[model samples]
Target: MTRPDVTLENYDDVYRFYLDHQQNRLLARAAYAALSARFRPRVRYADGARDRLRELLSSDTRLIVVANHLSDRDQYTLAATAWRTPLRRAVGRTRVLAKDELFVDPGLRRKIDMMGSIPVFRSKNHGLRAVADAGRRMMDVSAQRLHRGDVLAIFPEGTCNEGDPTRVQRINTGVGHIAVKARKLGTAPALLAIGISYGPDRSADVHVAAPVLELPGTPMDVTRLVTAELQGAVDHAVAAR
Candidate 1:
């Protein structure tokens, strides 16, 4: 059976509903804090990781953090590790471009939404209009956030490449679209490519590479460069294995 078509309206409605649920928000934050603390010790950063990240995140500049996806647990690890540095200030305030399927579960949905995740539909069979609408929604808000100097994080791979060790998948160009729109609005956010790789036994030792690109540039150029850098980081991490 084919999945139902998802539109930008669906995303807005669900996100607003989740946000209105205060109890869920409170519980989710508590859960996130607990999980982060539990796995804190196992998390490790490369030399100069903290300083480099701080320098990148310290700016009032708008940002889009594009990282490689690995597993469901990877999001939490990324969030937790990021929280350890100045990046935590962007939490709850920043937007995360995520998959639409995550909204299916009330609990998980609430948690992620509370964390400022914006769902992006990834249906291969879906019409172009639907995809465009979703992109428009993201652009509208993302541009505003950029104008306001807020950060936004996105996983350019769209989904986890769990078993693939040799290659990174082709990235959707929507990130480029968002950047272009934001720039046109006179608020182009800096695109930061981040590579996240799991450690031995997935024990929470996440290797976070520094920002690959920081200067403002054209959307397509930024997208291509960021993807290349992120892929290179993943390759290096894998090679060390």
Candidate 2:
């Protein structure tokens, strides 16, 4: 049943209430599992990558998974892969920073909202104010969730690069800001660099590198390290393609 105040204007507040009320992390896990099962895309991983991610989760680490965005399906593919891990199950909720357009359509919007995505506004007219407002909101929500020990996933590239099939472009600085803010609040989680690859058939393959760099440091340093690691991972993935 939908809540009384569950309108688009109050979407975030209502959604947060639902997530807190349900308190059922398994619902998210099950949803992702179903998505994966139906898709049934073959998954390949670097040796011990899953294990290493699980280990990181075992620690009090709040992760900001930086991946090179390729397609709309990329997010779901990553969610499916993460769901396969007991680590994600243990971590509770995995929140994704998604574009505001995803919420334009009622059905897709509902699904994204249920999946714990924070809608961000990106303007083509170079509206800096809208972008900044969205960024601030995203950071605030991410910081709050990180405080609760939830893993936050973001595509630092800002948008999917369909033109560049070879490598990831330079990353946006928003990711670094979120990391630094989380640290200033007290518990600064490790920033994890996640590289996602898609085969020609659209099957998903993932490689998670070590924390490219630690947080509670300067935002520029974190952004630089994340960009380098993500670029390298995308290069590797493209080579395999």
Candidate 3:
């Protein structure tokens, strides 16, 4: 059944699930298992990505994993890919940043929360105080999570490109802001870019580019660096198509 009152205005149990940090590891494993069993995506890494991924996984620094969004099933495929790749060990601790609207779907919401997704409320809807404040709170907590060593996997483009799935859209500045804030507070994490290309045969191609380690200058500078790298990744991933 669909949940109608799951909005931030009436946050109830649905929205609460999004705010909760205690993720069920068993459920997460189960979700990944089910995803793999059902839809087997052929995940492939780019040159030197395998070795780099292993090194990144072994490190204690948090990872800000950014990827291109294509469909609703992107998250599932991401989790499954991580489980099969060198990131398998770190999947359980990663928090997937998802839109708050996804929580409105009772069925999907449960699976999203179980798989360790963090709800994000965008403030572009209306400029109301509450909405703006929620956005600020999201950024603050997200920064804190990174400082605490929790990996965040977010879609910088914000939404899926329905008009042209092959191309990556413009990135929002939120990700860069979070990274800069984290750097200022001391603990600096790696900005890793991931690209996904889905085939007609239900198989998916996954590529992980090298990580961005240097965080210099202002937030805009860091944001542009990450944005350009991610765009390059998306273009490279879909170049064959």
Highest-scoring model, lDDT: 3
TM-score head-to-head 1 vs 2, winner: 2
Candidate 3, pairs of clashing residues: none
C-alpha TM-scores of all predictions: 0.78, 0.83, 0.86
lDDT of 3 at 9: 63
lDDT of 2 at 223: 88
What TM-score should be assigned to candidate 3? 0.86
For this target, which candidate reaches the highest TM-score against the unseen true structure? 3
Measured with C-alpha atoms, the lDDT of residue 128 in candidate 3 is: 53
Query: Which portions of model 1 miss their true places by more than 4 Å?
Result: 1-32, 41-49, 125-129, 212-216, 239-241
lDDT of 3 by residue, 1-241 (tens): 2333546665344344434465677777777877877766666556787787788778876788898888887887788777777767775677888888877777877777677777776655444565665565666677777787778888888877787766778788888888877777787888888887887875677767877777655767777877777777766767644
Error of 2 at 215 (Å): 2.8
- lDDT digits (tens) for residues 111-202 of candidate 1: 77677666676755355676676556666666666676667788787767857744677777777777777778787565555555566667
lDDT value for model 1 = 0.64
- After superposition, the stretches of candidate 2 with alpha carbons farther than 4 Å from their true spots are 1-24, 40-48, 90-92
